[model samples]
Target: MSPSVAFGTDIDERTKAAEQSSTDVLTAPDVPWNLVIWNDPVNLMSYVSYVFQSYFGYSESKAHKLMMEVHKKGRSIVAHGSKEQVEQHAVAMHGFGLWATVEKAASGNETPGKGGRQRG
Candidate 1:
């Protein structure tokens, strides 16, 4: 096969792949955000920590840290990712008696991994 023919074939394949990638990106919905629970007067610190563990499965230390942030700082990014996900988290937080709300994560900071309370 001619060198030009081989190179042209590769270019065509690359272009097609790029087009597919662009399409996927364009069609993808923005990931739902998170509902962060702020510290409140009603819930005990330990109870908040327990809720984090029981509901979010965060480790004890991690849950404690977040709880402290809420207690001391008054708020923290307790949960994260897609709007729907955050809404669900907010509802769950409410059920647990923690205040929560959904918001878009800042740009250039995608891919929030798991960070919930510890398992039994």
Candidate 2:
């Protein structure tokens, strides 16, 4: 039998390569973005909370807390993820009649394009 087959060298080498590849993938950094929801007079608190629950799948308590934060603070960071994801969330909030925007969480700066839209 070949030395590789007799001693499981092939399996060992494959395992080492797999571990290295997984480690490289796991260590890669990702830039984050934040979806900020602004309080608006047009949306009721319950409706805002409902939107949070429905869109984000957050529990009632979590949605209510975030909604209250928006109410009291004028704005709240409702979600965080990749720029595309946060932007999508902001757009969904817009569809719900809530003022929302997405900003780069890494630099704490707003991204370009429709990220800064507000209800007129």
Best-fitting candidate, measured by lDDT?
Answer: 2
Q: Estimate each model's TM-score.
A: 0.62, 0.63
Collision pairs in model 2: none
lDDT of 1: 0.58
lDDT tens digits by residue: candidate 2, 1-120: 011112244655633443333233223355466778888888999999887665555557767878898899788876665665566556657766899988767664542212212111
Model 2, residue 28: displacement in angstroms? 11
lDDT of 1 by residue, 7-103 (tens): 2446555344433432332234664454567767889988988876655555678778888887887777765544545565576577667888777
The per-residue C-alpha lDDT of model 2 at residue 44 equals 98
Model 1 off-target regions past 4 Å? 1-32, 108-120
> Model 2 reaches what TM-score against the true structure?
0.63
